[model samples]
Target: MDARITKAEAALLLPATTIPSRRLAEVEAIRLAAIAARDEAVADGVRRAGQAMLNAAEALVRALVTFPARIDTYRALRRLSDRELRDIGMTRFDIPRVFDPSFATRAANDSPQAPQRAA
Candidate 1:
């Protein structure tokens, strides 16, 4: 019915043939299936990359915020008197060690005077 499809005026137009509907459907189905598969792969790739980027952004934000807080705490701790540090069960020399949990244990163990627990 389309105007672009010229009506056969001669026998050489393959005029007797009707395009098969079933084969057309089959080809269309295969093409659609291929497109769906490609879409799924692209979605999966975006999801994976998005997750990794999200994690990296979270880590960067934490590091940015945490470093400033830790530095501020270190400066504050440095300003404290030995008596004040002792009241908190820490020493002037233990400031850096206190910031690092791995070294905190060693520093605590090295201390001759542990905090006396009240009965």
Candidate 2:
């Protein structure tokens, strides 16, 4: 009796096992751990972004609500013509709208007046 085998034939006859079952188990564990870590990181980022956006919105609401007088002052100043502002014991230079926006609008609305700028 004589037996002969080619490398190609041997390879074809061998059972395919790219990874041993134990190693496959380890690889699957690692993959699952990595996926879990990635999910946690993504969730944390979303939570932080949501919190920051909420903070900014709250601040905007407070600014608009608390500073109504200041906004009104600006409107009052705007209503005055450049020439008129110059005449009424005020001036574009003296009470520059940029420096004190609240003054112009203080009297225009029924809203409570802010403390007047001391003369």
Best by lDDT: 1
Q: Taking the tens digit of each residue's C-alpha lDDT, what string does model 1 give over 1-119?
A: 65564445433576333555787778889999999999999999999999999999998998888998889989999999988887776777778866675755564335657655689
- Would you list the clashing residue pairs of candidate 2? 72-105, 73-102, 73-105, 76-104
TM-score (all chains, Cα) for each model: 0.45, 0.44
Q: How high is the CA lDDT of each candidate model?
A: 0.78, 0.69
Model 2: weakest 10-residue lDDT segment is 107-116
**Candidate 2 residue spans exceeding 4 A from truth:** 1-20, 69-119
Off by over 4 Å in 1: 1-18, 72-119
Q: Write the per-residue lDDT of candidate 2 for residues 1-119, one digit (tens) a residue.
A: 65998898988887756536988778889999999999999999999999999999998997888687766776787788866764454554444444455654554322232234568
**Every model: Cα RMSD to truth:** 8.3, 10.1
